[model samples]
Target: MTASTVLYEPSKDGITTITINRPAVRNAVNHATSLKLAEAFQKFENDASQKVCIFTGAGTNFCAGYDLHEVAGNSTGEVAVGPVDKVNGAFGPMGPSRMQLSKPIIAAISGHAVAGGLELSLLADMRVVDTTAVFGVFCRRFGVPLIDGGTVRLPKVVGQGRALDMILTGRPVDAQEALAFGLANRVVPKGQAVEAARALARDLLGFPQKCMQADLVSAHYSAYDSPSLEDALRFEFARGALVVAEESVQGAKKFDKGAGRGGKFEKGKL
Candidate 1:
């Protein structure tokens, strides 16, 4: 377990937990923070022992977005550290409101998830918001638009009209409303979102890996309307065929061993 400023702790069962550490600034992401995130994500990906990743922030907020003060500042003192490179993403893309992660990532959000914070929460494959949690696309009012996955993923997770309502108005939605909108999978008491997320990850660990990935791929592909229904079906068939070779064979054996429908799914737990 490598030491990291941005806490990255994994359980024995392959669930890597990542907690944003800058609580002093509402866990606002900065250059150093992004690097830590990237390193943690890459490590988890390479471990092979890990399967799922859970992301959360320490303290009263999940993430307040980027460090605005740092972004606004122009000076770096008298260290004589050469020119400031304009190339962004010096830190990896694993920061708040970032890119698509290959493995399923769960977010446990408590307190406020506003602006880029809310956008960051959207990165997770599944989100469990605290009952007191608040979500807002508030950056519209501040002129900082959801630069991450907001404009794109939000509409798909919720409905287009609902997403537009939030984006256009920059209104805050509570946990119950988020659940109704499908933005969050579950809602729990404040400070318990992480526990809930862990339980969900444990459940996911029981599911077949190849089957889940194939299903995940098909679901992602389903989001894009194909040229024809047949084309879409063909894509699903191909994904399904790949999984059938692995999980299907084991599934048959499970049935033979009296572990059929509704019984506990065997987990190789790699």
Candidate 2:
């Protein structure tokens, strides 16, 4: 992989911003770029100092998906998609798409986040999109399948009917529509996605880390792992019970003194 294929920048305040740099093909992931992307996310995961991640693309676009040129050149039937152990840190065709990351990730989408790009965005806990951002299953026309958690995650994100419509039709869903679909958490003006995501990260930083992470894991487990309502409640209670002694007691004490009352949040006071 080229050195510039992916850029990993970690801020002093615990935010890691990972950018795909191949804008020539709208930041498409070639095999080499995919390796770089996997490595970049690995680096972020290893760093205990980093609390949040902002995944984005350089130039105007987020990513156009995998580079079909590489696929066109392959005479052998070998492809980027393969069997992976999702519990371990296995690289997907779109890099970190298969792994369950510990920290929160926010995707700052500026342009087309389509096909595999759309799958990549699904890896994020939240997507902060700009006015120009476009999302779709653009590879349907090319007979390409969603190999990197797209089928599983898309249905979970936008529900079965909406996901099937996008998957079958390959129609572009604009930013406003994506917001309505719950595909996007926040939408901003053009050229402001990254800044908006960074600002959101700052807010996340103010919260107690362990409590936030525990809640995040619980939510994900309930969404994807829990077999029944009883099991989900049991798991949530077990996880949250640990945080009560660690963080909730202190938080409650602060609330008693009016730290976060009346919906007023002061970072230092909290």
Candidate 3:
């Protein structure tokens, strides 16, 4: 805990792994740690060489949520929240929770991801959770609100009823239940979440970058920004069309060369 509470490690293959290192407190996020986490994610966003990000917590847990100790000792009269500028992006008290990252992020969940931690995981495009992973709105029990994207994202990830069940009841959802609820994209063996997320990131890296990013952006826009079905389709088509000439043409040529024939994938070929 003496060292940085957040750690950032970048691999040569365009994978940046951001870790919450406060395992002593179940990797809880405090004001300082939240700022550090936001900075790390902003660094990843600014680095064009970093294609994907894997977010996890060190030791046994993903994150227990925001440090209640810090919240209880807030005598400075200043709001314990990160800066917010919705036009560009914003950071929540949990840090990076409000960021609209261009690159894909995979949440590697192992232990408890409750309250704010659950909100943090919702920021990721995908979650690779281990058997021990748990998701909940534990903050409900403490009368804490989900100021992060939890309230918005949770309903989108799972249905409104399911999200409400967890939100109102403050019950823990195990990995299996989370997967069934669409909260977890993949469930792996205990202790293998990070590796699985890294492997998934490698698979994503093998694809045409522009096309993948365009698709990702389009999907996000449709999910959260589009006004209607027509607007969503228009945005998707516009963005996807931009990448067609840039990546799809080459991908088509690769396909013609049988690189991905019969559903057989050749890494990095297309």
Candidate 4:
């Protein structure tokens, strides 16, 4: 694959879909592809008009993992992944895995999302999978360690027992099982993962932008950054307070005018 190994598509309706385009290798990410993936995500974050991002891969599989062929070629003890430091600037082997995006991202998983691919899916706020999708720590059998956010995020996502099971066994968890484990937010038909993810993104795009982003940031802070419950609450309050005047007042006025009543919902209503 060329530089197009990563495809970045931004729609006018505030949805950016980033695709891993190396289908020939089941979208296995190599060094160049990893850099492109990181760049695409940064672009999406920088574009204020893009409210939601749908991350998927080309053809069938979502991703196999970091391209082991590339790793095989590395005779030196050099890191195939980009620079890593103790700060927030760290980059994972799967690229954007380290990013704590302010906006929402949905992963559209169709086929094998194992090893680093599983880690990549964890980067999304939600995963929309199809019947063919599979999740696992496949790299465990190859003696490859997960240097991405996999170890940190998997436990938070699926609990300690389940995370340990996947980490220890490297077994394939099908779409249905993943849904039962709360790993997959939605399961669609065999080929509709991306479409389902797009619909989900549309729903998110309809919300009050500032208020939604503030809540998103606060949730991440509470989940990963806050040292204690008190700190989390204080951070949440502080972040939310900044959005009240900007979005909350107008949203309340709209609500008073009979919007979002009777449990009704429509795209772009807000």
Candidate 5:
């Protein structure tokens, strides 16, 4: 009911954790909650010091989906749709699903991540799922379409054939199965998704930031924006070359000095 339904927690070590707090409805994002989520993520994006984001929901669940109760109450029988501007990006019905984040965000999943919830999880660079986590296109039973990048990103993440199986059947995919499908990057014991994600975020922070971000952006472009393999290669080289002078030189020096010998990461030293 209030903006506080979405909570933002920024750590001193540069990990920002954004939580959906409406556990009453299993953390479903209503219109107001969606706006709050968008605002919170925008804040994270704007803070240069914040390097990674951990996205999760409060209580037992990740998210059920967009609040259908809100849809049920709409007098016009239509949910409000935001205007889209592909260049600058725009808010989707599920808040920041349309955003192309400069830095990586990890989804720390517990319970259901279905329908719009599943789409939201797809927004992250990777997902850390607990044993209790469940993923599905649950809105299909109600004729609700996957409007928040589900149809687009899901295939890219898990392959088109696998994506079609989930999209068409609307069957629930549990954490272990999700790992095999390449949906969940890591599966931990129940209630440890957030902690695992935070640990992974810290690992990311230990890397050379410019080079990591450059590679991340290049990967995203190759997956969604590039016209062809050659174009993707050109884009990657250009972006990576910019980072070479800025970070790779220093990283190479560290490597040469045996700072990262035997494939061991020295945390902050890196």
Candidate 6:
């Protein structure tokens, strides 16, 4: 009910759900909301029981952007406040995306994810945007800058040239364009985004967490250059070696004993 609270839930399939509940203002990140989001993410990060997370808005609109009403009132640029020295920068302490979650997260976007909202969506490992979803670097129109991870992540997700086009032109892109540009992993029917994300999360749980984490870490950190590539591989091996040490050994025994996935897992019944 208050501006500071965001919604948090652990779903039936060990899919933690973090919902932006301030739909009246399209889930704008206020100071309180930011704190709550950080807290919720903390829980997700620590819970080994949860294999995935789903972030979504409570209503039709995913997020309209920053609560300009709240932003307008801040005079803290001259003074230090909450975690950061300035106020106009991205919603630092208040964003679910600024912090990285090791477990996979799927974003379910229903409507518009503009400016900060779009930045938030970009945080997820995979995103299921509604076919009618609208994405934009909307803050440019109002002279607001993207101080969040958007400036950094957008170019990585989409190309730098495309990112520049959005930032410079402030164009609203439909879900199709977002899909084409690799901004979203999947586009679903409107109002079905959350459902699709949830289903994917459920499916993801079938995989071994250790392997998933090892692969994710390697893929994210690896580079084409020899040194960085070698370091990434070393990290991956260090992490993966533990799984291979015992867990995978036991898993192999199980399959050999007929309890393993390979033997019982028929064509596609799972």
Report the number of clashing residue pairs per model.
1, 0, 0, 0, 0, 3
lDDT of 1 by residue, 1-270 (tens): 643459989878889999888788888776677666766776876787888999898887888775666555635421111112222533222243444555788999988787767777877789998987888876686565555567877898898999999999988899999999999899999889999998889888887877886777676667645677788889899989987977988878877877755555444232
Better of 3 and 6 by TM-score: 3
The sequence of per-residue lDDT tens digits that candidate 6 reaches over residues 18-51 is 9999877878777667667767877898988877
Pick out the ten consecutive residues of candidate 2 with the lowest summed lDDT.
80-89
TM-score of candidate 6 relative to the true fold = 0.85
Evaluated at residue 118, the lDDT of candidate 3 is 97
Please list the residue runs of candidate 2 whose C-alpha ends up more than 4 Å from where it truly belongs after superposition: 1-3, 82-89, 267-269
- Residue-wise C-alpha lDDT for candidate 3, range 21-118, written one tens digit per residue: 99999998988898899999999999999999999999999999988898878765144553444225477888888878889999999999999999
TM-score of 2: 0.94
- Tens-digit lDDT string for candidate 4 (138-195): 9999889888888999998999999999999999999999999999999999999999
What's the distance in Å from true for residue 87, model 5? 12
Residue 28, model 6: lDDT of: 76
Clashing pairs in 6: 4-32, 4-33, 34-94
- List per-candidate RMSD values in Å: 4.9, 2.2, 2.1, 1.9, 2.1, 3.9
Q: In candidate 4, how many Å is residue 197 off? A: 0.6
Q: lDDT (CA) for every model shown?
A: 0.75, 0.90, 0.90, 0.91, 0.91, 0.76
Quote the lDDT for 184 in model 6: 85
User: Model 5, residue 93: displacement in angstroms?
Assistant: 0.3
